[model samples]
Target chain A: MEHAATAPEPGPARVAELRRSRPRSPLLRFSALAGVALLVWAWAAGDIYESHLTAEQKGANLDRFLAKLTPAPVRESGDWSDFAPWAVRLLGEGRGAEAVLLTFALATAAAALSGVFALIFLPGAARNLANPDPLGIRGGRGGLAAAGWHAVSRCTRAFFVFTRSLPEYVLGFLLISVLGPDPWALVLALAVHNFGILGRLGAGVGENTPPGPARPVVAHGGGRLGAYLSALLPASFNRMVVYFFYRWETCVREATVLGMLGVVSLGYLITDAKSGRAFDQMVFFVLLGALIVLAGDLLSALVRRWLRYERT
Target chain B: MNGALQRCAGSRRATLLGIALAALLCGWLLGLDPRRLFADGTLGLAGEFFSAAFRPALSYEDPVPGAQPFLLAALRSLLDTLRFAVLAMAVAVPCGALLSFFASSAWWPDLRRHRALGLALRALHSTSRAAMAFARSIHELLWGLLFITAIGLSSEAAVIAVAIPYSGILAKIYSEMLEEHARDAQEALRSIGAGGLAAFAFGLLPRALPDIVSYTFYRLECALRTAAVFGFIGIETIGYRIRLASDEFHYREIWTYLYLLFALVALIEWWGAAIRRRLKT
Candidate 1:
């Protein structure tokens, strides 16, 4: 304890010293790329809606997509069309609790895998985000106020760069192209995307560790990576749990949408039902997906409370 | 003490790199290779096809019946794409937000709420997320295809395909946002005996409202893109038009529509960003 009293005060000199050196810039490149991608996505969506479907076609599509699968078959209705009703009917099959359970089970597994990856990525991110600047000093001159504001602005940029950089669909699109239509393809796609997401959160939580621990370790000849793991990761442990539960829930939604690659989750079921004109079954799958999202929310909430209880 | 290059030789990085390589391998198996066009002479054929996409000359003759209604048809396809995306966002946001509360930590304080309540809520939350995730995993084209087969080729089919997944996405994202801000304000509001609904309204809503709107716009943009892609299957959406024009050797129409789609996305981003800035202030 007495060893701490001899520690030198880190002031503007130290601030200037740290600021002179470069900060890693990979994060910046990723942010810019993400911004560009988002713009492109927006342009594509805006230019392509109205002319996609004709009035008559739109009516028939909606009806068929919503139809329910029955034991009985139906004759084709219009003179201009030769569309079959099997896809929607198969999707809109009977409302079995078992089907809902099966769907949820698959989605949960996917989410859990992403959560595990998030856990793996957290330690690395936390270390990289450790601020070298000392506490109680200004961010600009030598005061606390400047430091606080700088931190906020930098963090905000990072946050935006993180969340908006990649959409799940884009990831799914890329992965589906690469990994085929398997269920694991969707899972892997969601996982990589989630990795980027949770990594940013982990970095934010670890941003407050004082430089003392990291500086001392580095000065004593320890590697930068060592200082990061020891000082940064440990400091942010408390916040990791909260983000974990939250991300897991998100994975569930991603799993559903990404599963549109013919990987049978409830979404696949919905599409099939819609194709078969199985209205009731389509509704069932939609409702079922909604319900599963709700359950993930609750589970995460429970996990959060448990973490808080542990902390207390 | 160690060199940066030396540090890079760790087992973890190698493992990560290996895993990525495997994923790449799997991706290869999926047949998503854009290079396939060249190998099959498909690229040269595509060039010829897309050349016509530009043919219907951007003359004053367009929108007049004689030469080609190129400009008008392009504009019309663009509108349809925008409409599909907007409508999908409309359906997705509210439902996602409303359900987000249930998914958020704001609802469950402890794992043991009550004997039956805990079990029931647990089931409900899990099911909701699972359902959303699974639903969203499907592609819009497939969704369109599914709907097309069931309901026949129509805009409604496109809308359903887009909405189902976007809803899952919005709900998941919104819930995560809520949980990240679950402390303090929420706790204080709860301490005041605010009901769940009241606490959400008084404490959380204000902070999240702007972000929610921004993301909704973002999702709208995404849905539009997905809807366009779906247009390739059967729908006459912008994507479908581009594909059709290209297929029919109408390069001018294809270029016109594709550019229109790109422009619309930029405009939405600009407007959305402006609104976000205003809100921030």
Candidate 2:
């Protein structure tokens, strides 16, 4: 009865507290909009000014596009050249959109392709970790036996150190010369670099689950695979999802970079914008590329949220 | 222990077979008609480069000429890269920490409000987070490419463009750190007379500062490497300069330029870390 009385008394007070706690939504909106605006304005100023300079410096390429933007002869020739679509003339016809579309398409394709590659390449490694490896045994009767575990640990540690030390950029640079420039080359390169990251992340997930699970399975004389399936897989599934998203984000960036080598994609738009001397188009495309990545991350977050919290 | 030990023994044969096949493949690809390398007293071109590479390129008296231009160029570019890292950290760490207060559930007492606010905050966080992420994910090369076209080919655009994505990453990490460590303290502050923002500042900020600084330096080091990577868009940073020298067929100068960059990057990192340690003390 006292609990009920106290609850009724506090209910009105709690509602008042929320109103006080909430910041002025308008003020919050104003600040956020202003902040974003300020950054955009600053970036635009710098971006626009540089674009102008590049257009001027690059010479005749912009002449064709700029000329198209300028008013032509009064009596239009009715030829396809006489009348230009707004973005077409402004962006030098379809090239800008094409570049954007192409690169975005490539990134999407690469993500799917890599998933397939992972499914194929990872099973052995997964089994190796999940199942007991008689192959790892070093037969030594004395204290030398302890060294075996140490060696195994050292190898695992070294694998991580080597995998993460070099970013894919460096790897791409090294492989570019060795393999020569092929579209497939970049794909292989991206996959290899990403594989290192994925494997390390995967191993971490396997090792870091709660102890209760594996102990019970192992205590029952279950094999390594049994312990892993019973204990680790379920626990690590959450981490695996997050890691995949992170890798996908990295892959998107790599696909853009690979474009520099004439691999062709969205980065090509960036190159075209600069080369064609259309600074405005450059801004549009940069925003576009940024949006695509932003979307990917949002998707990842959505999945993570769904998995992380269960409905009471 | 027995099972674990047995596993190791089994992998050795596989490991040996893998090496043998790899060696065989290498020989096949390199035109390893072993008869030529073994029968003829010629060490071949690769062998020749390896042997020659071991010999030092310069003495105190005879300094390499092409080396300095490349090194200086790389040094200048690397400085820009380092600047990007520092500035990105500066921008991102605070923003990320600020956002985390809202993103986490510490501010809410009841289930209904928390769920609604949590969803909203998550959406906002993810979108902004995505912006920051994509900003970095699009390689600085792409960033450089667009910026060079739009903003012109200056080091400043390169730096800022590169920084945008990194800052996004930094913010994301910082938010996660805040979520993990400051949840309880933030809640305690919120339960009392403290406002959410106020509680976050007092409760979370102090604990997060050390980590922020440590991670900032870590990110700074990463940025340094990225700066070199930015050469693709013609930034003429250390990496770009090296590629240029190589194109000009100055192999010895390439090594020299690389060494200079290594020495400089190492020095800067050590100096920065020392300063941080001292500051912490």
- Leading candidate by lDDT: 1
lDDT of each: 0.57, 0.53
Instruction: Give lDDT tens digits, candidate 2, residues B111-135.
Output: 4557886677668657765555555
Clashes of each: 101, 24
Model 2 Cα lDDT, one tens digit per residue, A213-291: 6656665666555666556655565566567666766676566656656545555565666566555555555565666
Off by over 4 Å in 2: A1-145, A211-231, A309-312, B1-84, B87-139, B176-182, B195-198, B206-218, B234-236, B245-281
Model 1: residues with Cα > 4 Å off, grouped in runs: A1-312, B1-12, B27-43, B46-68, B105-124
Task: Specify the poorest-scoring 10-residue window by lDDT in model 1 chain A.
Answer: A130-139
TM-score of chain B of 2: 0.63
Best DockQ among the predictions, by candidate number: 2
Cα TM-score of candidate 2: 0.58
Global Cα RMSD, each model: 14.0, 12.7
lDDT of 1 at A95: 33
TM-score of each: 0.50, 0.58
